[model samples]
Target: MAFECVSRTDVGLRRKVNEDSLLVRTERGLWAVADGMGGHEAGDVASAKVTEALMRLPVVYGLDSMIESAIVALQRVNQELIALAKGNAQRTIGSTVVGLGIMNGRYSCFWAGDSRAYRLRGDQLIQLTRDHSLVQDLVSAGMLDPAEAESHPNANIITRAVGVAEELKVDTVGGDVMPGDQFLLASDGLTRLVEAQELASTLSSNGPAEAADRLIETVLARGAPDNVSIIIAKAT
Candidate 1:
């Protein structure tokens, strides 16, 4: 199967710089989104390092092998960032990553922090990755309402991310891929402002290019306060 992919990034209305990075290698069937931790030193560098590492990953066959390679690559970048931070007086420089890999009719999503992956199969839209933020944990435990999680003052406090600790934990999920299936990888900037129903409808009505354009446009229209990055891939 072949994938038709499109990607875009914006600094948004409030941010002075875009600290989000994306990768779209259609021939390799690999795509990713990385969001730098806001208000941190060299956030753009941290996110760029993530995509740079993923871009260098060796080609591997099978969904399992693809996921493994990505994990290894990310781990290396994690260590690099950690060491760099220590040299700079122990300031944390981190980034959240979400990636999608496809091989032999199957798809895999691997991630850390709050960047997300979603699948649009027919009329159904499913979130494939979960946020590692404190707010997400509270919501999962039923201590906080879902509607309130987004506005919680600690919504930006992520529990895990590359460069945040010596050891990084990345999560993976996968399933069989079908023709006409659509996949989306995005930073929280877009997801925070746009609702899931709107995402599903946009993906269902347009191809990769148009869908990506509309999503970014919607985020900017809603007064984007953070960097936004989006990638859309459709199987054929």
Candidate 2:
């Protein structure tokens, strides 16, 4: 199967620079979104490192091999970022990553931090990756309500991220791919402003490019405060 892909990134209304990075290699069936966290310490560099690492990954034959290669590549990038941070007096520089890889008739979703992967199968939209943020932990532990988690003071405090530690742990999930399956990978900037229902509605009504355009437009309409990045892919 071939994929129709579209990706976009914006600095938004408040941020001075865009720290988000994206990768879309249609030939390799690899797509990713990375949202960098450091402000003056070059968050954009951290995100760019992630995409660069992914770009170096060898094209494998099977879904499982591809997933393994992706994990290794991300780990290497994490180490490189750690070394970069050490050279700069250890100021934290990191990024949240969410990636999708397809091979044969299957797809793999992998992530760290709050960047998300959502799959739209037919009329149903499903969030394929779970967030690794403090608010998410609280919500999962039943210590906070789902609706209130968004407004929680620590909502932006992510529990895990690439390049933040000596060893990175990535979460991976896979499933059989079907014709007409639509996948979205996005940073928190877009999700913070657009509701899931709105996303579902917009994606369902348009093709990949239009869907990506509309999503970014929606964020801009809400006076986006952070860098927004998104990638949309449809199997054909």
Candidate 3:
């Protein structure tokens, strides 16, 4: 099986810097999205460093190896960012990350923080990665409504991310890859503004390129308040 991908990033209407970064390597069947914390220093730097590290991954033979390579890469970058922050006298410089790896007719998704991964199969749209944020925690514990979590004042407060702590814990999920399955990796900027059903309709009706364009257009039309980055990959 092979994969095709399309990607896009924008600074949005409110942010001065586009701190989100992404990776799209269809040949390797790997893709990722990283979003630097806006409240942290040099968010752009943190995110850029992450993609750079992932881009250097050597060719691997299987899905397990591919996922392991990605985990090591994130851990290495996590420590690098921690040191960088200490050098700059900052408390933390962090970024949320989500990645997708496909091999041997299967897909594995790994993530930290609130950056997300989703799968569109037929007419059903499933969120593959969950947010590691305060709002998500509250909702999980039944303290906050899922709908209200989006508009919560603490919505942006992620509980985990690269460079935020000495140890980075990445969450992962995997499944058999079916033909025509569509996968999306995106920063919270886009997900926060675009609803899942809308994303499902957009992705189902369009090809990767057009889907990417329409997703960004939707965010922009809503007066995007944060940097947005997205990648759409389809199995063939």
Off by over 4 Å in 2: 38-40
Clashes of 2: 0
lDDT of 2: 0.90
Cα lDDT computed for each candidate against the true fold = 0.93, 0.90, 0.93
Looking at candidate 1, what is the lDDT of residue 117?
96
| TM-score: model 2 vs. ground truth | 0.97
Residue-level lDDT tens digits of model 3 in 99-166: 99998999999999999999999989999988999999999999999989899999988999999999
Candidate 1 global CA lDDT score: 0.93
Q: Per-residue lDDT for 125 in model 3?
A: 98
Candidate 2 per-residue C-alpha lDDT over 31-133 given as tens digits, one digit per residue, 9 for 90 to 100: 9999998363778999999998998898678888988998999998899889988898867889989999998989999999999999999989999999999
Candidate 1 residue-wise lDDT, 56-151, digit = tens: 988776779888989999999999999999999868989999999988898999999999999999989999999999999999999999999888
